[model samples]
Target: MKAIANALIVTIASASSALAASGAAADEGGFLAPLFLAFGAAIIAFQAIPAVMLLGSMVKGFFSKKAEAGANAR
Candidate 1:
């Protein structure tokens, strides 16, 4: 649990730093600025997929176990 909390803190810090850097770069307004911004947004969006999937699986497992236990009791 402590390890997970540390990892979460690190991830948030890293993401905040990347976003700050990206915002600074975006203000420069070159040809590639929009492209880079879009790419960064895409990367963040893609990263969420696995996290969502893992959370979904955990919720499903928890409910399924409860359902089975209720059925067994009946």
Candidate 2:
């Protein structure tokens, strides 16, 4: 448990430093700014695919239950 706690603290500290470094990049005046923006946009676009699939699956499940119930009644 003590080792796990130490590891967690180290991970958090390193992550915070990395975030600070990324923030510093913005102050350097447009070096690869467009590339970073495009990367961020692409990340968001890729994430949307799984979300849409989950929504479609949920809708399919909902209607399939209704269809099954209707057929069973007949």
Task: Give the alpha carbon lDDT tens digit for every residue of 1-74 in model 1.
Answer: 99999999999988987777665544667789799999999999999999999999999888873545666684
lDDT of each: 0.86, 0.86
Q: Candidate 2 has what TM-score?
A: 0.47
Clashes of 2: 0
**Residue 29: error of model 1 in Å?**
0.9
List candidate 1 segments past 4 Å from native: 1-28, 66-74
Weakest ten-residue segment in model 1 by summed lDDT: 65-74
Model 2: residues with Cα > 4 Å off, grouped in runs: 1-28, 66-74
Q: lDDT score, residue 54, model 1? A: 97
